[model samples]
Target chain A: MNDASSQDPEQQSMPPLGADHPSVARILRRWRQLSGGRHTRDPDRKTLVACSGGADSVALAIALAQIPSSCVLAHIQHDMRTPEQAEHDRAYVEALAKRLGVDCAFGIAAVSEEPGNLEANAREARYQELARIADEHACPYIATGHHADDQLETLLMHLMRGSGTRGMSGMRPATPLGNKTLLRPLLEIPRNEIETMLRELDIAWCHDQTNDDPAYVRNRIRQDLLPLLRRLDPEIARHASQWSQDLVAMQEVMDERVEATLMEPCTITDSQWRWPRELLQAHPDIMLGYLPGLYCLRVLDNEGADRITRRAIDSWIRSVKSDSNNPTEHRIGPIVAHIRAHEVRFTPAESSELST
Target chain B: MNDASSQDPEQQSMPPLGADHPSVARILRRWRQLSGGRHTRDPDRKTLVACSGGADSVALAIALAQIPSSCVLAHIQHDMRTPEQAEHDRAYVEALAKRLGVDCAFGIAAVSEEPGNLEANAREARYQELARIADEHACPYIATGHHADDQLETLLMHLMRGSGTRGMSGMRPATPLGNKTLLRPLLEIPRNEIETMLRELDIAWCHDQTNDDPAYVRNRIRQDLLPLLRRLDPEIARHASQWSQDLVAMQEVMDERVEATLMEPCTITDSQWRWPRELLQAHPDIMLGYLPGLYCLRVLDNEGADRITRRAIDSWIRSVKSDSNNPTEHRIGPIVAHIRAHEVRFTPAESSELST
Candidate 1:
């Protein structure tokens, strides 16, 4: 590890370690830090990396290739862009992975087949395809190319939506996806640094033309908000990620309190999700905290998180958090709330399932 | 008061009550909501309001005047700007306060005599002067002109500096200031609306040149950062303030945990602050929570909050939170620690204070 304390005796905080160091060195340092002090990925364990043939991912792929760990590159052609561009990206990823002696997994996403927002569809399909690829390759950790710039944009996007602590916590460096662990090695690294690293290595990368669209809020934040923030504070991007990181730590501690006090003793049965009536009515604030978890468990079909508004949550809370503890029926989307004597139950909207 | 449910039956949340209503109505609704169902401030009790000749505070003054409450206007001429301009502002405030039948307490700030950063000095002096005026007028609540835009700017400023949850929580709607309560009736309102309110009323307000100078970090944020954020999300200003409000709630809960678990049983006697060594060592995370409370109680000179940096807090935590329970001493700014036996002791930097 780079001892910034030793380098600058006055500087106490982390001081964005390896920020001033070389591009490859910075990535190596950051990757090691992400590995929970393991220093490097074990040679025996093969890792799957999601590469989009864009500068950030391509840069990450290049860095990982230089290391000793075995790697598998997964690329999904969303086909949202032109066919020629998609094919070009696929060919590029294949060639790059092959050159680095890494196994490559390529998939075509049914972007048009998917419903809702194009970005959401592309993102969900990409993640699903990556998970499948990781499973096939027996890779536990699937690293991505989400860098500091992306982190800033994500945090800002959450702020614009008026999201709570969880949303403002931005994306985690590591998270479980189905049975596999998804990782972001370049998360600590800035976008320009990744570009610099690839430039220094004399490697070219493909650009996604769709990213330029102002229709996407994330794109607008990246292309606009970040620059203005930077003008006010030169290191705004770094701080944006850092602030979220601090909030993430704070959230973990607070989440424990919520779990211990508010959301405790709630059980998930195969047919119905249940919470005690007393617990449901006691703390109304925790209802907000518990909404996302319950929604994911209840809602199906697609990513309906955005669709599941606060109204639905409040409506649920009001239904259960009532004076009379009698069995009652309430319907919302594809879920049915069966409020009973001791507990509140949530089942499928279809009454036939309840009958079964 | 506007009951949003009555106005919009389908709306889940309050949906910004009187948002589309007249400017005065929106401000009045927000003020009433701030009162937390008290309806309005008691006419019997006087409330001191800190007003600059600026539009936001001027509009707040105008709105407050319309309501049935005793208001005392408090204005501070920093003397940092031109004498002519300062005199002009004082005259303007006096006339406005008189026109509204509100008692005015205008004061000149000793900003030049104070220490530290110009902005900090000016702010501290202004607040101190307001508190004094509030005390003189026998007022319990001192209202400030910190609107939603200012709150957003404050939050963004803290984030850029990598401040933790305490800093990110932004400002309080009400806080205990000695025997009085510091209030922000206009906190929920936006700056643009405040301007619109004044403009619609055909009331002219003084513009402070200091606010336009790019030398101040805040000015840059207002002129540059806010516009860019607005472009991405039109309601960014409102959301920023709303996000902070949610964080404040979360912080309150977490603070209870900190008080119950960590800061509980710690004692302060004479000039010495004591905490059990085991308790201090066991919870390093809670140290961040406990720092502000301890610092405020310990530090004597003015607010001194901005002076109490994270480095100083961490240093104090580290000095006391060590393995050996030996008689050792460490100093941080004006505070000194003497670690011995089962308890960590904190005293003034100089031993002369103990002798005195």
Candidate 2:
């Protein structure tokens, strides 16, 4: 542990340890900002850092340890890698944690194959394992090493899937992981900086051998699409990362507008919801564009809201605008929109009779 | 050329000429919707179809001819192509126009190579020629053959450049092309459907030889990135196109909010603009996220507002929050943000002292 603050008064004139590495300082500052300027030595500020023994996570751990808060290194051994490689990863993470003078927790990921979604399943399993580790360690936050490049890759993947603004908004800096707050303090930092910082500190990290497998779509995007995009625009990653931040900001506004204009004015329950058609007509910009998908997510709690199509929303809007006195039903995920002359009502498909 | 509506009453009892191919009718209906249901035979509704002798443009011409309104096929002979190829394109467009019983217009595009931006320069030159031809032909609208695939391509291009929602919104269905309205009636239609309609109608179109040239970034993206994305998700094009539409809708909402909240309350002039600090603090979601770029556009009329960066905006916001009574200035595009105690002022850099 490079404890720069504990230097002797005899060496007070000298620059602090790690002063030459500005990236470490940036990481520390960013983490503090993300945590809302909490006291550095706050007893409640325990974070379990998820480390794959990669340069990104190792650098994160190094910077995070400098904070006076309690820090723990966590590793999830997944089934995708061979036993030898997995052991090597765990060993490297253990040694790195020991060097940082932090306790380490190791867990095996029960990654089960789900037809064509093996990669997604593995990620879910890994996160679940991380949550369990955080629980055992009594940490309120679990931090990851996702950086700007990963943010770009995640955004492209969402774009490829035709996800609208919500998906393109990319990962939030801090979001919920089970009951714990998942913190990604280095999201705005680039991958090169993480690797460069590690090299400067003479810290060795193990490479995750499974990352090159083309079986995962993310690898293909990273290997093929990213390089091609970089060639087209060298600042693409920086631009995209910034765009992601902007989208997040924009999404925050949209969510607030939707909540105030649509959700608040509506009568909502677990199985049924109703909104005034007059309000819908008054704010077509919000009603026709953002309300449908958001209503599904916030009101109905539909997890597959992404599957809602633009055509479906258009059709629903048409129904909402129709002057017919009779009721018309339109499907939107698990719920159905029953539009009448003065109001638009939504009911779960199983409770269609309730609308009648 | 396929005059389905001119059938005799006896033949009208049967199916129409294009009844089997529903796509042509879809195109015509879409055109009428795009034009706000103007009288079909209105002489003022003349449109200059920017035909490149490609399948998409040819299909558009075929559909537009079905409308009773006047139509003229326009072609631009660009320097990027050989004279022989340019002549071939012009000849094909002329023959098609003649076959459709409409007039044709031709113009030469003096496309100058701008260092490494030959492709962009050629496109701009082509559009300028199109606008000129539209003006010469007394056409109020200039229609293009940009379909959903092109929209997806555009969104990806903007994404690579790290453009926010405004860029990712892709091409508008109708926007100002010089003095004329540029209409993309086939924007929602897919490229495959356009080609299929052309093949079904037995219409011949010349392949765009320059399209496959790898020197152009668009060509590389079309060939490499699009195909890779399609493999990941077969409906990626449709999804991105829909996302673009959603983004356009979201942007409309954002624009309206910014106008009503920020622009409406501001004291703006050609060289100076001031916004209340209290209003800004009240709506950080709108003020912090959208006001910077949009203010550059709406207030300063700065065409390069896209160059207004997130960092610049963040810095400006920080200054706006500063408690200092002394004025501080920050550069944003061609204008400078001056932060004062009660308000934030913007002035052209040449006129900075006015902000004091």
List of chain A TM-scores, every candidate: 0.75, 0.88
lDDT of 1 at A149: 78
User: Best-fitting candidate, measured by TM-score?
Assistant: 2
Span of 10 residues, lowest total lDDT, candidate 1 chain A: A12-21
Top-lDDT candidate index: 2
Residue-by-residue lDDT tens digits, candidate 1, B66-132: 5324567888877787889888988989998877656788876776656667777777777788889
lDDT, model 1, position B186: 71
Determine the backbone clash count of candidate 1: 0
Q: DockQ values for all predictions?
A: 0.46, 0.51
Tell me the TM-score of chain B in each candidate.
0.77, 0.88
lDDT of 1 by residue, A1-356 (tens): 23333433444343432234367566655655565546444553456888888998877676655442356788887766788988888899999987665678987677776667777777788889988888898877788888887898888888888775678889998787888777787776667777876776678888855355334788777677777777777777677776767677667767677667655676866756677777767764633445445545545543444455545655667766667766777655466667787787766666535485
Candidate 1's DockQ is 0.46
* Residue pairs in candidate 2 whose N, alpha carbon or C atoms collide under 3 angstroms: none
The TM-score of predicted model 1 comes to: 0.79
lDDT tens digits, residue span B156-220, model 2: 78876666557767999888876888889899888888899988888889996545443566777
Q: Taking the candidates one at a time, how many backbone clashes does each contain?
A: 0, 0
Tens-digit per-residue lDDT, A178-232, candidate 2: 7898989899887877888888888888885535544566877888778877787
